[model samples]
Target: MSVHRVYLPDLGHGDFEPGAVLEITGQEARHAVRVKRLMPGDVLEILNGQGLRAVAVLGESRKHPAGHGKTEWAVDVRIESVAQEPPISPRLHVLACAPKLTRVEDMVDQLSQVGAAAWFPLVTRHTLTPPKAERVDKLERVAAEAAKQCGRAWTMEIGSPVPLADALSRTHRAIRPSARLVIADPRGAPYSPDGSTDLALLIGPEAGFTDDEVDAACRAGAMLCSIGPHLMRVGTAAVVASGLILNAEQPR
Candidate 1:
């Protein structure tokens, strides 16, 4: 099994110092101590999941380093060091229809694995999945779990599920002019791939965008684009678009 990268907010104080005892509690402790069966001297990396990481050592109990036949585990972890990484480049944000339950969860997981800056759930005309307010927490958990599995230094940010029209209006107001917007149409014209520094990719449901939806997106400055000859699943299309966006952004 791989050494899990656990994300805990209070890994250390203001200036992260190496070798400071980090206290792990709740689910994290259960995972590392009970489930993981991690013994003293085992090493794991601790991430605040906001771009900071530290190496930590496991210890058994408050009175650690016990000899003889006693085995109560404690996270007597000392952060080796905290190295902050640069933020994700050319932020690739995704806007997609809210798919069904299992599908949406999988999409969120896949989106995090593909390094999207944020996932915005969209409700379109043909969107069959009713946006569940309570599911936001479920989505967040999926994102965090997926990020952990993928070694991402940041938890995937999930925006509230909004109507497609409202989402477009908000996008126009929220993003800068240079932020390229691309809509996946399967029938759209090919766009120049060079203008993707901070991109927003919009994907419709399996039913594709309605005529009105297309027109609205166009009015809102979204360029129509295609992902080549084959039709792809909503989740697959999002991944492909994110990859294309990441590749198109110019190297700084």
Candidate 2:
């Protein structure tokens, strides 16, 4: 059976050397013990979200009393080994106009699974429904869950909504300096990997970008590229464009 994985945001704060014992508490511990029925000696992996992963074997578990005779579960796992994975290359940062309703959640989930470094909602002239703070928080949770399911050591980041102009300007350079910017447009040139290690891909909304938006992007050194000939929804275009950029090889 595939070893179950759990997230530990503080994994780096503690020593994860072989033979060390670490306590996993709260929901994570409860899920492993109660839901998974993982007993002593069961194996699992713990990821720190920042590339540290530790293989561990389950140890003793205990329950701490909450008020009113309620109890919370905690599990101890002994570290077997630890490994750090390097970040994926040609890191793709997707900035797409939010799709209507809950479709944005599905977009975030798929982007996480496909190894997009991060995602930001693009606030464009044609954007109908921009994500709110609560939605952003929920998307972060979704990204965390996707990391565990996909066995990714690093979880994809969820960024706040960014306006098209700000996203294309040097003011945002600190976010991903030297990153090549690409805007997905139906009338653009064919997409190709340009040997850039970092990329920021912009996907427009259902109504599409204004003519001025596309023109400004071009003037700001952004390339207009098309993933396919057919029209795609905001979410679908984000995933398809991200996949093409991430999986393609750089010119030799």
Candidate 3:
């Protein structure tokens, strides 16, 4: 059976020894107790949202009063073992202009599943919608859930919405200096996965980027690359490009 995984934001907060007991509360507790129906002695896995993972066994379940006039369930688990997972190599960072909140959420989820190191939501001239802080929270939640589903210990970082110019200037920090900065454009070099470790992909809005924006990114040391001849939506382009890069990076 597939080991059920739960995200514990505080998993690495305290020192853990063998047989150490840890308490899990709130929605995560509900998922473990009510949804999974986990009982004492049930083996499960826990992630710290970093790279720390632990093998834990459920110890007990309890009902407690929540602040908002409701009862909530909490669970206790005993840590059996812990391990640190190494980060993905040649980190992949995707810089995608916001399409819409809903679409952006899906993009974040997909990228997280594909082991993207980070995601940047760019507000470009052709962007139809502006991303908000609330949506950033939603996107993070989606990424966390995707990480759990995909059996990844680390979650992708979602950056706050920023203008295209700001996003271009900050690209250097997102990846290594030697990493490739690929801007998705039709009139550019054809993409060929070179198994490079550091790659930052910049996906434009559905309406496409303006000439000045393209020139600015190129000046910032971005290489315009084409994913395909056909036009693709922002999310679709991200998924396809990320998949290709990841596939090429895989060990042969």
Candidate 4:
């Protein structure tokens, strides 16, 4: 089995186990303190989201007088035990567009679910939503949660948003002599990679790519690949292409 695959929070310190006291913090803490109605002595599973599976018993709830309406806090009462994790494989990066609102969130959530190496949100001419750093932060949180839940060995890296041209350049630099680059062009012919050293798969936006964008991407080192008969949404194409890339690289 793979090691406790949870991103961030370190999950260090503490001898985690049954009867151990732990405080839920941040949005997670808020959910537990406010929404869950968890009171003092409430025993719950305190997964560092890393699969430690430490059973945590909540002590008394305390409020801070230092700050105004200071949020609630929890303290772990006891320590149960701890466990180490196994190793996983190297990651594969997923470079894609910000598909606006629900679509973007869904993509972020799903990509992390699938164990992507990293996420690069590109700003193409067809990009309608200008994603703010705050929005990307939300994406990061979502990925972290997904990683914890899905037991991913490493957290997916959320990269800064760059221009499509810049993304093309990055792809060229990322590819090895033996590695291949494939871009999803609905009208392009089907051609898969030769061998997997590492891949930087590109997925375009809803309106797809302009002729200039396609030409630039091709020049930058991406192989034009088709999705067969029908056209797919940028989001759908991303998920599908990601699956294809990972599956193709996997040992048969």
Candidate 5:
């Protein structure tokens, strides 16, 4: 059986090689000691949430200073081995208007598990909810928790809301020549899976995209693609479209 996995946010991009020592503190520490009931000699997998994971054995537990005269548990771990995973292929990027706040975490969580490279809340003609920095920060935490459960070495990247024009411009500049841009539309071409290494998918809001918005996106090089005849909710369409694209990229 695989060991339980935990995410250590402060571990950063390096220093997780074999034989390294990691000190996990704060809420992560409390979860390990108090919730998981882990103690010295316990073994678990640790992830840096940036494509690196390690097998680590817990060392002695100690009390660490917390804010406002509070104290929290802390733990030390000896890293046994570390491996870095390459980013997922098809490199799926979903750009959409923000859904209801109640559904944001669920949307982020499932998308991370499905291996989306990033999620961008787009500001569009009919965008119901504008992006806020705090909400985007919360989505990051959601992605991290989802990654921990799915054993993903890397967490999904979340972006603050940007205008559709700016988002399209940035995407165009960043994507490679081989990458494909797709917009989800009911009257568009049927989604035929391809083996492209990178894909950028655009999904509109509940009210749908304005014709001008679609025209701008298409003019900027997005191919209109349809999920099916039936309309799907924003979050559902995002997950379903991603899965379809990824399934197409898989070896038959």
Candidate 6:
């Protein structure tokens, strides 16, 4: 059976050599002990979401009383091994317009699972509801949980909402000067991999992008492409586009 996984954002803080003992506290510890019922000798995988992964054997759990009459849980785990997973190739960054309600949360989870390097909420002309700070926080949490479940060493980054122009400019900066820009639209040609290691995909809102927005994107060097035969909601389109781009066969 695959070992259960937990996220430890501070896994890089200290030495993690074999046989090292690390105490897991806070929300993660509580979840492992209370919810997972992890016991002594149980093996688990811990990820730091920055390419660091550790295999550890569970030790004992301890509880401490708080002043407010609540108890906090902590668990000790003995490190068995540590490894750094390399980032996936053809890094995909998704910039999708915010969908209505909680669908954006689901999109983050799915994108993280599918190996998207990051997600940004695109504030397009047709976008009606941009994500708030609280929603962004929740999206981060969702990404973390999805990373643990999917066994990805690194978590998908959640970027703040940005306007279309800003989004284009940010991706064109020195960091990813070679990043391919793609916009999903019905009028574009079929999607294909161009073998660019870095790619930014834009998915418009339900009402779709305005002509001016499409013109701006094309002017910014974004390729207009169709992801599927039928129209899809914001979340679905993002996932489908990401999958196609991430899994496509690149030129040898």
Best by lDDT: 2
User: Which 10-residue window of candidate 4 scores lowest in summed lDDT?
Assistant: 1-10
Residue-wise C-alpha lDDT for candidate 2, range 1-252, written one tens digit per residue:
778998998658357988999888899999999999998999999998999888999999999887798999988999999998888887888989888888999999999998899998888898876888988889999999999999998999988878888888856642476889999998889887768998999999999999999999999898899889799998899999888888884334
RMSD of 5: 2.4
Model 2 is weakest, by summed lDDT over 10 consecutive residues, at 168-177
The digit string of per-residue lDDT tens for model 4 on 1-252 reads 332221226565455544455554455555556776666666554444343545455566555443676655543344455554432233466677778677888887888776566777767888776578888788878877877677654566778766777667764333344445678887777656465656777787888788999999889778787865778777777777777667666666
Q: Compose the digit string of candidate 5's lDDT tens values, residues 72-169.
A: 88888998988888887778888866789768788888899998988888778888876578777788999999999899887899976667886567
Highest TM-score against the true fold, candidate: 2
Model 1 residue 68 CA deviation in Å: 30
State which candidate, 1 or 2, has the greater TM-score: 2
Model 6, TM vs. native: 0.92
State the local distance difference test value for candidate 2.
0.88
Worst 10 residues of 6 by lDDT: 167-176
Which portions of model 6 show Cα errors greater than 4 Å? Answer: 169-175, 249-252
lDDT of each: 0.75, 0.88, 0.82, 0.65, 0.82, 0.86
Q: Name the regions of candidate 3 deviating beyond 4 angstroms.
A: 67-70, 167-172
Q: Against the true structure, what is each candidate's TM-score?
A: 0.85, 0.94, 0.88, 0.69, 0.88, 0.92
What is candidate 1's TM-score against the reference?
0.85
lDDT by residue (tens digit), candidate 6, 44-120 = 99899999888999999999775699989989999999998878787888889888887888899999999999998
Where model 2 places Cα greater than 4 Å from the true spot, the runs are 173-175, 249-252
Collision count for each candidate, in order:
3, 0, 1, 10, 0, 0
